[model samples]
Target chain A: MASSIRDELLKVLIEHQPHFLSGEEISRRVGCSRAAIWKHIEELRHEGYEIEAKPRNGYRLVYRPDRVAPEELAPHLQTKRFGRHIRYEYSTPSTQTLAHQWAREGAPEGAVVIAEEQVQGKGRMGRTWHSPPQTGVWMSLILRPPISLAEASQLTLLASVGVQQGIKRVTGLPIQIKWPNDLLIHGKKVCGILTELRGEQDQIHYMIIGIGINVNTTSEHWPEELKKIATSLAIESGGHLHRATLIAAILKELEEVYQEYLNSGFRVIKSKWEQAAGMLGKTITARTPQGLITGVAERLNESGALLIRTDQGVIPVYSADIDWKEI
Target chain B: MASSIRDELLKVLIEHQPHFLSGEEISRRVGCSRAAIWKHIEELRHEGYEIEAKPRNGYRLVYRPDRVAPEELAPHLQTKRFGRHIRYEYSTPSTQTLAHQWAREGAPEGAVVIAEEQVQGKGRMGRTWHSPPQTGVWMSLILRPPISLAEASQLTLLASVGVQQGIKRVTGLPIQIKWPNDLLIHGKKVCGILTELRGEQDQIHYMIIGIGINVNTTSEHWPEELKKIATSLAIESGGHLHRATLIAAILKELEEVYQEYLNSGFRVIKSKWEQAAGMLGKTITARTPQGLITGVAERLNESGALLIRTDQGVIPVYSADIDWKEI
Candidate 1:
């Protein structure tokens, strides 16, 4: 297959990076003709990879692109199939839009849409997200889960746990998962998870879990309004991170958590999340459209709804903007 | 606007149906040019209505198609904007798909999509619906309700109440909303509802509520296997029913109920539904993926989950396939 030939050529280039190989040498190494090597090189160039070709020398990897490519990142990935079918976009309005379209068009499970820049990325409540070019991980994954919408909220908690674990694994920075869907680092938000679904009353057709992490972005990249409440991996680690590796790790962890969630209930994920849950047993004020409700964060119920024990009663809050009290 | 022009032309045609009118006469009646009349007629024809025009005699109404056209149905509708903006299609894969797309594309709050037939119409549990041409109401409404996903099941009940009220208003047939999402007449299904949503943790962007009703279908038109379980309005009413009028009534009732629901809680709708509920205090068996639960259907909780008093306790059933013991 043409894909296999291209894969072989990519393997050779990756192995002999920073070195120039003649066309004849590459062809011989990949067990293909020099013309085939040239074709694959052209294709790689079209894919935003920088492969320099000289007259006598075959090809040299002058610059390696930081993209979520299976060939480049699969060796570092631990799980299967989650990040295997990735679609990289240089600029898109929204990764959630692309993922939903792909899911409707029968894209395989574990399909991902990653964009280097988003012109109109969104957060919860129709808020505009700050996704600068090549400074963060803005990705969405298509998940085909056999669950009801009532149980769908668990996916948000699961994704938060995975993102927390991934960030911990990459930069050794401790992170906490806020009650519903925020990844907090040093008491500031470092990532947000938006889970959306399309399904009937009893069956879910597909769900798109979108994640936006401020990786490699400096505090200066954030707007003045968000500087106090937002943090990034680069700012925490005092160095820039490899976006491709971090994304691969996040996808792998997400796949693992997703499988665990499907096999077992949210018990495992919930246990891990509870360990990193910083707001449990603390008094907090949640501002809902109905009104503000101040209560102690009791625990998460079986369906992933936040249980708040107030003076009135134990109210299962489906969604609210939380404001924690000073510890 | 061109749409207003088309509305005017539609008004003229409906007012003077079954009679041939010269282009000049139509232009004079609507104060528009003959060329504008011809263009509006073309647009209406493209919207699935049948209009025959002769060179000199004029345009004759060959078929007054039963479709949910904004202009044709708006005058008869009593709603406050819900279903006021209509998009009619002769054939579509599914109205819900189109409605979802429109909702994502920032369509208005009360936008609706109606189709004469759906090639890939789907019901709950991945079942293919029987939506033959001009035989059913394949309609989907875009609703932006201020509710969480956990509370969305109530919307299905609200829609069922509205549908039952509409059918009662038009045909005087007493119908019941089978728990969760079906409209039944005389122990057989006449309509099915599918509600889907797209949103994040703390906010709901939009929801598409799809309704499929067997309106003018005959026994022979249904699949042989479905004949025992499905019935149409014509079958029950002992006469032919106009699809456009029925759709308009449904939308009008839906708008009223939706407005009340947004203004208040589900108290009004739930009380109305409880009066027509056929399964209350009845022994029922629900087959869920977890296990089969046998209990007496006591009531519905505030969140719209079915409360079944089983031997263990009062089990709150969120999603299940139910079977009536007497049926």
Candidate 2:
């Protein structure tokens, strides 16, 4: 509640920047006492804001810090459901684990777990995901869809499209979805998605979609082995990006797409995914448990199984690791 | 370990009943001192076993309590997977809850959690399952099958056939499977099965199959509300039945059928299920979520969905509650 008051005070200060506003005016606007307004200004100054106060002049704002605090981002959210109840952390093991724990305890749908950094971030199939502090958008979204288990892969595809469109809208950079769960820019990976579900037989209980995006990470921040394979927005665009703005944009797109999918069906999402897919019609090799199958990537079936046309037949690949050397 | 030793001592006394076996001879056979044997016998007597002790005659077993202990059940398990590790509880809230928790913690396949009674036993669709003390087989079996999520209902059918055959072999009574997950004897439900799974997209982590069998529960043991719809083996067979023997028989049958299904697919299991089905070829009314689907229950498809031939078309029912007036 105190933080909300500070936000109200900050909003007032930003509106009257470069000019002095009286303490009496601020107290009246924020419904607080003049002494309370002075205390709030002191707290705001401690939070890396430059506020000048004189005997005659009341207060004037100069600068603000670059942070993704909730009080800073809550006012920017445009979605109806997603990120309404956000669990923000500075550092944690994995947001996916926390999302699963929260969903088990009957957390409301669209609850999000976001972290500035992950100490032990997990990717698909027990792989490690690189998540450094304050340079990426690392978060997990909780959903309790009424769809069956077979449609889970399609939901993952839908989320990938949402992330791709979000980054393109914010940065004006061309983004491409690489088949199932990755987003690429100029042939380098920028985002990875992992979708998990908990259910009983034919019905689903809840789903946790963990998304990790490389936002402002530079080449120096990447590990030696990953420097050639991974690239961030700042590295490709030659400019640093604000993390909170991009996060809010992505959440808005995701929530809109999710609601649309629930209302109608997956047709709209399927079309958007196919339009952004980088693997369609490409000659690729999918490494499955059976063996390597080199074929031309066809369209995704209704159940989101990738249909690969090989020499034998059109094989529906439910899960595999795809490689496109020409791309 | 002490309880196991007492079981062994009880076994020794039962094997040497009506004959005078001195304490020295019993100690030599069990690899324990005379004082230890005496202590074990005293403990066994406290566990509702009447043992006669004399100066020269070591001990004679008069009676044994009707309880399903691990020692009594483990020797009869003839399977490679099912019931290899048993977690026996004298009383618990529900074995299904415990089984799901253990599965989440990476419990091994074929782990069984059994309770003599349940305070909060649950049925499908949020119904109550009455489980009185030491009169029913309340257990949950953990299975990590290689099949997909859609085949879960078929696995439940396979288990029902296994239980039906096992009861027939033990008591020579006619048992019929009620379509998907119930076993009935004399038109009354004697067993209820609930199948739940934990999975992601196209992969499964583990499944818990909770089975509640009315083994030795008499008519007087059931609540008034349940007496009309529930029956037990003891009440039907006109004699007291041993729960350990029935449980061991069911496990062996289940393990064999499950292995066969994995190797040769669901054909054999489906045929067996159809042979024992009570609703097949009968006009039944199914209370589905959509509405009441009244039709002739034709047969089970390969995925275990029941095909009901209605006037409109043959609709495949994944889950529903059925009502049949006569077989």
Candidate 3:
């Protein structure tokens, strides 16, 4: 909450850039004390903002920070509802846990929970997601779509396309969706998404979509186990990318695709997802809960389960770890 | 929780029935003070238990209460897990709400939430269920089933059969399931079951099966709107029924069916449910969310959705209100 107030103060300082604004005047503009303005200025400087300060001439903003603070991201967020209720945290265990609680407490659709770092980040099947501080876009979106529980898997597929397109639009990165919800660049994972739903009988109450992206994280920052299998935007693109811009782009893409899905149905989103799916027409081995099964990746049905054609016939794989070593 | 402690004192008094037991003896057995034991005896008397107190001869139990207290129910509850961790409430808004929270907090499977009365009882599709004080079995069972989200509807059907057999065994009244989750006796609704699920993309975290039975409620106990459609075991059988015994019997039936459903599959439960389904091979008017659809109720599919053979095709109806007036 204090961070949000500081962000508002920073915004006021940025709006009065190139002209020196007095501490009292900036405090009046942002509705805080002069001491608060001074403190926020120091915090902004720590956040990489360059401010020109004089003894009596007040402060003048020289440069803005590249962080994904609320003041920086809210203006660029194009969605009508998505990302409107943003809960920004510098560090947290998991946004999915908070978002689930919010959904139970009747948080409106499109509320977002984003964090700079995660202490106990989780992936699907109880796996760990390495989230370094201030280097990735770790976020979760709370959705209350009026879809059946049977069709919830499609939303995971839909979110992959959203992230894929958002990255393509911002960084021109050639990202491919790995079957269900993992995004890959140059055959290594760059992002992962986990979708969870709460429902009654056949009706879905709400869903939480948690997306973790390795944005500006360096290879050396990765743990020894994750260094080989995971790649970041900085590693793949040969440069660092703006996290705020990428987050805004992804939320916009999700809102648009979601609106289309609600209006015209899942046919359009399914086609878009299939086009970006990487494992189609390839022979892969799926490590399912039952056992390992090798089959050709045929297509994704309407419910978003992968159709794998093996010697025993066509089997629908709802969930499995795919081994694409032959590729 | 206080009610449970008082119930423990009541159990101790009942165990020493016909013998005058001192307050000190009861307190030592229940691990409370003698004054607390006296207060619990007064509370139990207020709950309709008959007790006789003498100046120096101590106290003797004269009669047992007709209520479904924990002590009364636990002795009759024979299941291994179901009703083992019972949360008994004298009055609550709804057991379903409490059971949902308990499930979210990692409550074990088969943990039961039973209430004597509901101030704001809910039925299927946002309807109000009339739950009179101390006259009905209002309870919710928390189940952590190993099943897909698509198969959640089957648990509702399975619950219907449990309620059906339990009512049959206790009341000897011929009860039949009304297509999905409602149980009807003598062409009037006697019980209603609502099933809610929490899940991931394809995995079920837990499910809550809430059942409201008009066990001993009299005709005069119902509100004006429900008097015409609702009937109770007491009214139909011309005698009051024991709610604790009925509750234990239903939980035991649910445990057995659920165990079979998890092991041998839904085949046995489906057959049992079909045998007790009242609308089979009969044309029924269903008020579905999409619209009204009249058709002959065929067999239930593996997911427990009613497969109705309409004029167009065989459509699976997951949830709806069925009218059997034509039959």
DockQ top scorer:
1
| Candidate 2 residue spans exceeding 4 A from truth | A1-3, A9-29, A49-66, A147-158, A172-174, A178-180, A265-275, A289-304, A307-316, B1-4, B7-30, B50-62, B145-180, B261-277, B280-326
- TM-score to true structure, per model: 0.81, 0.84, 0.82
Query: Highest TM-score, which number?
Result: 2
iRMS, all models:
1.9, 3.6, 2.7
User: Model 2, range B1-327, lDDT digits (tens) per residue?
Assistant: 234655566667766866767889888877788999989888777888787888866677777677777766765667887887788899999998999999989888888998889999978755789999999899999998865444455677777878888888898887899867789988899999877777654456788888999988988887788899889988889998888888999898888888888788678999999999988999999976557999999998766778999999998776678999795
Look at candidate 1 and tell me the lDDT of residue B78: 73
Name model 3 segments beyond 4 Å from true: A1-47, A50-63, B1-47, B50-63, B284-289, B294-296, B299-304
Score chain A of each prediction against the true chain A by TM-score and list the results.
0.88, 0.92, 0.87
lDDT for B274 in candidate 1 is 84
Q: Candidate 3 iRMS, in Å?
A: 2.7
TM-score of chain B of 3: 0.87
Taken over the whole model, the C-alpha lDDT of each candidate is 0.83, 0.82, 0.83
What would the per-residue lDDT of candidate 3 be over residues A112-207, giving only the tens digit for each residue?
998989999988866788888989999999998875555567788888888899988988888888877899887789999988888765567889
* Docking class for candidate 3: acceptable
